[model samples]
Target chain A: MTRWGMVIDVGRCIGCQACTVACKVENLSPVDAWYAPVVEYEVGEYPDARMSYLPTLCNHCTDAPCVTACPSGALRRRDDGIVLADEDRCIGSRACMAACPYGALHLFEEASGEVLGDGSRGRPSLLEPYTAAGRIPGTVSKCTYCAHRIDFGTANGLMPGVDPLATPVCVVTCPAECRIFGDLDDPDSRVSRYTAERGPREVLRPDAQTGATTAYVGLS
Target chain B: MSAPVTAAPLPQNVFMDRWVLGPKTQRVWGLNHAIWFTLMGIGGGVFLVGRAFDVTTELGRVLGLPLVDVVSFVLIAIGGVVLIADLGRPLQAWRAFRNVKASWISWGAWADLVFLTFGGLLMLPDLEIGDSTPFSGLGWESEADGAGSVMLVLASIAAVVVMLYAGAVLARPRSIPYWHSVAVPFQFLASSLAMATATVLVLVVLDGDDVTSGQAVTLAVLSAALAVSMLLHLTTDKEAPGKKESIDRLVRGSSRTTFLFVSLLAGTALPALLALVAAAAGGARNALVVVALPLLVVGGFLLRLDTLKAGIYPPVTMPSVPARRTRG
Candidate 1:
């Protein structure tokens, strides 16, 4: 009954985009598609003006609108509360893209990987491990929270979010240590403790009533 | 002491179209979707009216097919094709058939398929195939009238569902301010009925069938409803954050030409006026039906296009507005 959740401490974020790069490289995501984008903006009037970064990603809602809207049942919620799209079953209707309030989901138009000059596809050795599981064109895709690494680590008797090898690339690579990912149901987990301390964290468009699991600290 | 307060500079990203949703962006369903909606709307509307009046007058057969059957079949068939073409993975389109719980598109796909297959079957009796053909006994005029009637009923129900389903799909995207209106679906229904009436008029003329007074009245009522729905859509209080901006875009911004001149003046008012005149002038003004019908139909399409193009996404970052009481 473990429910995976993300807690982003906006106060500690420096808008460095290291997590964005790490996520891109780890996922072999399209160059334009950033699974974790640090949105930098100025807030308040001139006298109180300050630059701030609010990083955003998939919320992985317990009541995901995308799952409900998906006609093919391609998008589904895992027992562990991770929302995923089954590529084989996807019809690419883009309904999930429309239903998502966070703008987290994206449609893969064309491959963004390296290609040789003579019309040949270039292979990246880092991405070779995920070749059988990479996204296909004409389908909607989003963050998976590094499910492969988590699964592999769990199989070898390691704890995700606690062990570096099992943690999401974004959380591990964030220089300012703004991101904390762990099971929300575990009272002893860091995320659970953080949630108890910062009881009124922010989730994007709470009015949408999607029951989003991703929460942001220092959002106000 | 409290810190001095001054006007904060507006966030640069607020004006940026990316990150913040606005004009000419955020079309999850685009031209193909609009086309499919239009075709299906017309087809369904035509079938409803055609059955209502029982207008079975046969125009001269082209390849042994009546004009009514040809038009309805083409509209629904092309709509089905366009719907399939809009999908990113057309090969996996069959997956839509696997689930029909909450998805309107899945229900629409099933309805479209049933309408096409059974509707084609219903047409078998009207066709002039030779007696030696194995399917000769299955014609509507033969022993198949009961079955044909049943198919027509089912197809008509399916067709009506298809018409409503198109609007529902567009309306359910809560993030888009322009699309999340009750008026939208009603506008679509009104336009569909008007377009179908206009199309039937054209077909009746082609079939050399005399235009009836009751048909004229029906067209008039539908046109009025269409006009009111358009007004309702434009004037409703859209309290969603960016909805007012979206409405402004349609009424006075980039989409004004089509919304005002085409959809309003040329499309709605002109047709309504002509239909009224024809109703007043009695049988003498049947020629006006020719001109008015095409205008009404084109106007119906323009209304849809305008509505589709006017859909603007609600801005991701909500803007700060100071509260003040003002006497209305």
Candidate 2:
């Protein structure tokens, strides 16, 4: 069983938002909802100041608080150790979203109506296509590791044509190639070896016992 | 030109006793609370009936009582009314469906309506028709009867949802941390149950019962447990900045002492002790249960009210800090 994880080398990242755009397109995320976001932070002052860009997505922790907090059993871990949401069972309670310390999950809202240039009401239509049965409005949506593409890729014994494993889209679309993704269970995997060779810092929320899978290397 | 100097006004701190809420929103929340209380009361009553009917072997006919069905109907009705009342425009509540993709409140409302209609339909056959009479020939039938077995199951499910919905409403990310815990639903359910038990004890006492030993003891134990849980939540967990400060103030101030001593000890503990003594003597436990019941109920109400008020703070998200080189 492959335990998927990612290694983000912040030292090499340029802060370009190509990954964010790619992720939005690949995941079909709604406007204002980014599965992968590049957070920029400024350091020092004046001429000597520097900026750091950290691309954040779901950590997919071993002890995911979201999974435990979901009362309806809508959020679950897949066989390959990926946290997935069963949209059909989701009641849109947003409890899982609250439990996530990393603010990864986004409660999606379908487009209700279009607004004219003068702010007048326009026609309303269903925005996103249903991916599962019994999926209703007002439910939480989040990064699914591009599970659909992953499944398709695994079945075809090839890399996903449409960015399967969604492997953190921001990482894949990075012009600097600072992001690496692979099975953490495999010692020789690119991500595993990279982290093993260069110590990486895992983001830890205070008092939260979640063991985050995503690691950041060469970050102060 | 000579600059004119302005005198600085002295700052007067205003103490807030009551917070004014929008009329419609306040009405919605008020109705929501009332409906939930009523449903919980009916559910508790049904459970009591089940205990009475089932535990007593001699009451064979009552064993098959429609207590559950009646409670289910009542719950559905209460839930329905709450959903309707929660809407901005009661008449145009159906517009809620327009944002089904993004609004949990709207979805939950629809679910409540569906469940209520379904549960009510299942309970129709067992509804009891009670004769109502006025001065002369005026009469009416009360549709409170239902098969206890079927109604119990439905009511139990609905009750769980009700509790979940209460918690879920406040469980948004980057929102109030006090309401963001996974234990919120459980806390709500436990408090609601405690309230129901207290209410029933009150009714029992008003009906001339002079003893309430068992009920009093239960209330005391539950109140203590709730207090402990609340304390743990406030102390151990990492809370939002505003919430933490407010809770700290509440606990350190006179509010804590008043709530613990007057509400918990005097209201709950004393009555529980009295009830225990009465029960031991095999005397009028009914009287004790009655006295303690009101106290317990009041204490529980205060507990919830204080917690809610104390935790009223806007949520804040800290700006991300840049990773920097530290002095080695």
Candidate 3:
């Protein structure tokens, strides 16, 4: 019922990868994997040219194609409408990866020299210790809206505490506060109010009918 | 030079004799190519089994037996073994799971594994149980009652994935136009089915068993439908650059014409006609069905081999154009 989503005000984005870095630190994601990527595109030519930066992550669509494409049921949507991955159930099929339109999912692989207690090395680990343990080899991963933290906060009837290490490093590190994440169901939430005041455009991939929940605002 | 006439300097053509084909061409035809061919062949075998099952289910009474499953399972097993053995690091194949984001080849391997496992379960009942006469009404103790049904469903799903994987792998961004279309997957699926039916027909004949006239006719009809669909898909659209080129290559026979025409048409069509004639004679036409089987098998293999070799690289222009222009 909580419908987790993000509102990226592209007008405010400066193309600096603060959100990207924050995401890496908060998620404890691999050095190469960026849970939130800010893609820069230049239009026109020379002096008259203009540039725009679009930050993209899991769209968490109402009809997520990745969900249907998964053969092992590893990818699922929670009761609160947050799409998440259950690493243990993943068989490493990658069907969901192929199905993703936004290229949001990052297939996590183990870093070199990082060995598990079971003697397995080079397996994927989320940078944050709390989420790292759930990473598995041959499996796909994507944004979870910090569901673990969100659940904890909900239980205590308080604002979700950012893991001193994980509180969505991207949201905290944003120099321009371009990326905003919150419960879309909460009328007073920043993301909800922003969407109501200035509607944002959702990124749509050709041939994919999934209606993405993540929206970008002020991109003409 | 003529005036000097010093043995005419022993013709420079001698240098031509030392020239050998380039390694790139050889590599294209080497082990990796063989693996591709072998995969297609195995796919053909699976197609045959599916066809045989369809035929037997429709005409078992006429044939006085349902032997299609028996023959199909054998061909499928043989093909599966060939594919698995062809893997470069067959032992360490489990490592394919390292990157799910970038690889469907790995997923294909897993699908094949599931297919083989479930296929074996389905075969046990046919091989060990031997007809319903002995194990009749065993009250849930029967093989058919337990793992057999479950395995059948699993194998069916895996088979669908197996059919689709070839197209999905080739449909990556910027690949040749021929392999880019959504229709490509369906095309592969159809062709594989046609090829598989043909393979089963051949094996059935080799087993010294005759297919019923009705069953043969049905299979022939399906084969014809598959052939027609293959042609239509190859010719209809010219939008996707990769797909158009692939279709052109298939039609012109530059690389795979011989395989496509001779093997697919000659092998499939000849037997299919025989089957049609046999069907017209009611259930008495066993001879024609026998003759059509081997042709179908060979034709199916040819179809698979051609499709696999008609490989296309991704569009490198946008990504690598600057380097090429500089070199030029």
TM-score of chain B of each: 0.85, 0.60, 0.64
DockQ of 1: 0.29
What is the TM-score ranking, best to worst?
1, 2, 3
lDDT of 1 by residue, B7-115 (tens): 9887554223243222234567667777888888888787777766666445444445556666777898898888888887888899987658878778888888888
Chain A TM-score for each of the predictions: 0.88, 0.84, 0.81
Residue A174, model 2, lDDT:
79
lDDT of model 1, residue A159:
85
Write one digit per residue (lDDT tens) for candidate 3, span B157-198: 776666666556545422234444565565556556655654
List model 3 lDDT by residue over A1-220, tens digit each.
5666777777889977777666666666644456777765554568878766666677777777666655556688777677887766665545565456555666654452255545566444334463445555445678876666677667766553233232344665778977776777787877777767776444434234465667666644
lDDT per residue (tens digit) for residues B1-328 in model 2: 9999998986542211111110000011232443544354335333443343232112221123243444444655665566555432245455444334444454455555555554445434433345321222212122233443555465445555544455455443323456556555445555555555555555445445443445556655655555556556667654555456546645765467655665556654665565566556546666555566566556555544444444433311122432322111
Tens digits of per-residue lDDT, candidate 1, A20-114, equal: 78988898775346777777667778998877777778889888888878889889999988898787788889988877777788776544444
Report fnat in order of the candidates.
Answer: 0.38, 0.03, 0.00
Q: Which 10 consecutive positions of candidate 1 chain B have the poorest summed lDDT? A: B319-328
Q: List-wise, what DockQ does each model earn? A: 0.29, 0.05, 0.02
Models sorted by lDDT, best on top? 1, 3, 2
DockQ computed for model 3 against the true two-chain complex using alpha carbons: 0.02
